[model samples]
Target chain A: MAKMHVKMTVNGKAVEALAEPRTLLIHFLREELNLTGPHIGCDTSHCGACTVDLDGKSVKSCTLFVGQANGAEITTIEGIANADGSLHVLQEMFREHHGLQCGFCTPGMIVRARRLLAENPDPTEAEVRFGISGNLCRCTGYQNIVKAILAAAATLNAEKEAAQ
Target chain B: MIPAPFEYHRPASLAEATGLLAELGEDAHVLAGGHSLIPMMKLRLAAPEHLIDLQDIAELKGIARTDGEGGGEIVIGAMTTQHELIASDELARAVPLIREAALQIADPQVRYLGTIGGNVANGDPGNDMPGLMQCLDAAFELDGPNGRRRVAAREFYRSAYVTAREDGEILSRIRIPLPAPGHGFAYEKLKRKIGDYATAAAAVLLTVSGGRCGSASVALTNLADTPVFAADAGAALAGSDLGAAAVDAAVAAALAAIDPAADNRGPVAFKQHVAGVMLRRAIARATERATERAAEQTV
Candidate 1:
């Protein structure tokens, strides 16, 4: 198999790499780009540990090949922080709400939650759970994880209102 | 697991895609949203030598209403995602059953990338769209080296992972004739979890007038090797009042049509029982909506 030239924007940076068409996007992001924020849990697209925002959609990176992601813009958990390197509201809420126990699913959960909040800034409890249904968190039992997302949504909405 | 290495081609147009498919022949596979194919690739169950990604093809990507013989039909580009289907208010208003079934598919992340074309074209019995499409009597448009052709959804599926689609052909679009105005619709799916496939499901569309069923279409999903279009079931409720007896008869007809092999979901008896329950619920809900639609129209 021949390696294909892949070019894409990840975490606001232009990236170009040569990868085999069989190289999964999760491997490309973690290996070629050194962006390991996205974890590969199930590798079968069942676990959302590989979730990332690709072209405004939350997609599992493990299921996508480098060839499929070529020329697409992507955001991983590393891109969720503010420009000054401060914690994102979701990250803060996760800590305050005890959203994680083992933290293995945190990166994917927060990355997915970021997109969920972006799509629906003021999601209800059920909406938050439904929005992040793809991402699994075995340690948290999703009780506090849901709470953290709802809290993050409230905080984000307040910030927007304050700026307005 | 990593997929076997394959050559990738992103075609800018449908012509180029079809050309590549014709050239590559059986060694090539068309990539839609890739939710289905990618997993198969990773599992090594399907190892085509060439992958033709259709994402760049602008032609296969929208929802539009076109004038046709019986009222108008909604033409959906095959690349349209499940998320797009749920987001299209026009589709929701025209063929709400689609949105209803699309929502019951995979979870949010999977739905974001799962294409309607991949769902129906794959001929997976577990997929909800095939039966729903059959209930709506949709047409699948296929393009290949020979020419473009249309296959009715009712006649498309031959078995699991097999369909009316031929080699070097791509399902370009789905054309669903708009249901009669104010027709009742419901897609009842029973699944163990959010992302799991349906154990047994039902799609129902019917119109009620003067407290009697006017026209009805019923289809079941995950009940057989192919999505079963319960023609006898639909016929069973055509003129009845949609009363208990009529629904029971329809359920019986639907149960008779399905040959469900026991799997993780349940044994044959349990599946049949659930299928009957799902059909009964779908018919009742559809009838209620039909009656409500009729009342609203009279107002």
Candidate 2:
């Protein structure tokens, strides 16, 4: 198979690369772009470690090919930080709440949590658990992970009210 | 696990896609969402020499009602994502069971990229849509060298990973006839955890009038080689109030139709029991909703 020229916006930057049709998006991001924030816990779609926001929706990057992501705007954990280099609200909550233990699933969990908050800014504990159900954290036992997401949601909502 | 190398084609039109499929021959596969296909490719279960992606075709997108009059059928483009289905207000109003079943498919991420066409057209017994489509009596619209054709959802599945779809034909749209006004519907699934395939699931749609069932349809998922339409089970509820005796008869008929294989979920006997349980739950919910609708109409 010939290499296909793929161009897309990644982490708010334009990126163009030549990739084979079979190259998974996770590999393309981690290898070609060196955006290793997204981990590959399971090459299969079962593990949400490769989760990323693509065109306003969270999708498993490992299951999609680069050719399929062509022309779409994508965001990984690297893009989750503040533009001024401060930690994102979700990241801060994760840190404060000890949402992670080994940190292998943190990136994907945080990324997915960010989207969950975006979609439902004020979620209950059960809703938060259901929202991040795709992203697993074996180390944290999910107790603090759910707490972190709920805390971030409340903080974000407060910030929005203050700004208004 | 990396997939084998294959030529990729993103056709701009349905004609081009079918032409590519015809020219590429039997070794080609249509790529839509690729939640199922890509995984199979990586596992080496499917190694198509040519991959024709249907994402670029404009005609294979969007959800709209057919132009026919009198509660026109809801036609969803095959490429519409499962997330889209869950969010569609039209689908919720026309066929709320779709939203119910789609929400139970996988978690948020997989739902974002998985397409309804891929789920139903592939004839994966584990997929939720095929059985729900059967319950709704939906039709799949196919486009190919022979032009357009529609196949009833119940008749489309031949076996696991096999369907009535021809090699050159592409499932372009899914047409669901509008359920009668105030009809009740539900999809009950029993799974080990979130994002897991159903151990056994049931979809039921029915209309109740004056505390009796006017009509009913029942279908089961992951309990057979193909999604099973329990016609006899559905018939058992018609003209009855869905009392304990009628519900038991329906559950028995549904359990009889299921041919579950022992897998990680459970043994055959356990699956059979679970299938009956799912059916009874689905029937009860449908009956309750129908009764509510009937009460509201009187008000």
Candidate 3:
């Protein structure tokens, strides 16, 4: 197959690249775009290490081809932090609550959690559990991950209330 | 997981997509969300010579109402992602069972990349939506060189890894008729974990009147060669009160239709048992919801 041209907005930047039709979004990000925060764990969709934010939703990057994302908007974990590297609230909570171990699943975890908190600003422990259930962390058994999500929710809610 | 090399076509319109599919014949695969096809392609389990990427066709996207005057049907484009279905307020109000079923599908990331049309069009038994579609009596529209044809959900699947897809036909849209005002629907599934495929799944949508089930539709997935429509099992509720006896009869009918394989998910006996239990739970929930709708009408 011939290489296909894809134009999409990535990390708030307009990106146009030529890729093989079979090139996965994960590969396009990690190799072509050089955004390495999104890891490739299980090539089979079983592992969520290749998750990324696409058009306001978290999707498995491995499951999609680059041609599929043409004209789409995508956000990798690198984009989660502020311009000067200040952490997103979820990242701060994950660090403060010790939510990650080894961090293979962190990017996907952060990406999935970002949308979870967006949908349900204050989720219960069960909701948090359900929210990140798509992601798998081999090192941590998920106790602290749940706590970190709960803490992030509180922080976000408090910020919202204070703003009001 | 690098997939095998293949020619790609992103047709801008439905007519172009059908033309591409026709030109490529069986060598072509319509790339909806690629949640299923890309994985299998990467595994080298199935490789196609041409990939007719369907995402570019705007006509094959979005959710809208189209039953003559917008009072009878909800038409979901074949490329409507699971995430789209879950977040659709229109679907939530019209057929919450679809939203509920969409909610439980392989978690968020998969749901984001997976489409209901892909789920049913792929015809995988492990998919959570086909049984629900069957229960709802959804209609699948197909467009090819011969123009358009709509296949009933009951007759969609031909096997576990196959459907009634023609040599060059692409599933254009999925049309689900709105349920009766007093109808209720539920999907019951037993998975080992949050994102696992159901060991067995049972879906029920009941239309009852005057304290008795006027009609009911039931379907089971992953327990048969194809998504099975339990006409007799659904008939078990006909003229029967929405009580334990009705659930029991529904369970019996569902089991009678099941022909499950004994695999790692569970043994045949265990799968049957779980199927029965889940069917009852789904039926009971549907009954309650339908009853509430009836009360709301009276109010």
RMSD of each: 0.9, 1.2, 1.9
Q: Which stretches of model 3 miss by more than 4 angstroms?
A: B66-71
Clashes of each: 0, 0, 0
Best by TM-score: 1
Candidate DockQ scores, in order:
0.88, 0.87, 0.80
- Tens digit per residue, CA lDDT, model 2, A14-81: 99989999999999999999999999998888879999999998989999999999999999999989
Native-to-model Cα distance after best TM-score fit, residue A80 in candidate 2, in Å = 1.4
lDDT per residue (tens digit) for residues A1-164 in model 1: 88899999999999988899889999999998888889989998888999999999999999888888899999999998999999999999999999999998999999999988888888889888888888888887899999999999999888889999
Q: What ordering of candidates by TM-score runs from best to worst?
A: 1, 2, 3
Using DockQ as the measure, name the better of candidate 2 and candidate 3: 2
How far off is residue B200 in model 1, in Å?
A: 0.3
Residue A60 lDDT in candidate 2: 91
With candidate 3 superimposed using the best TM-score fit, by how many Å does residue A58's alpha carbon deviate from the native? 0.7
List lDDT for all candidates, in order: 0.93, 0.92, 0.87
The DockQ leader among the candidates is 1
- Which has the better TM-score: candidate 1, or candidate 3? 1
Candidate 2: where are CA atoms >4 Å away?
Answer: B66-71
Clashes of 2: 0
The full ranking of all candidates by lDDT, starting with the best, is 1, 2, 3
Clashes of 1: 0
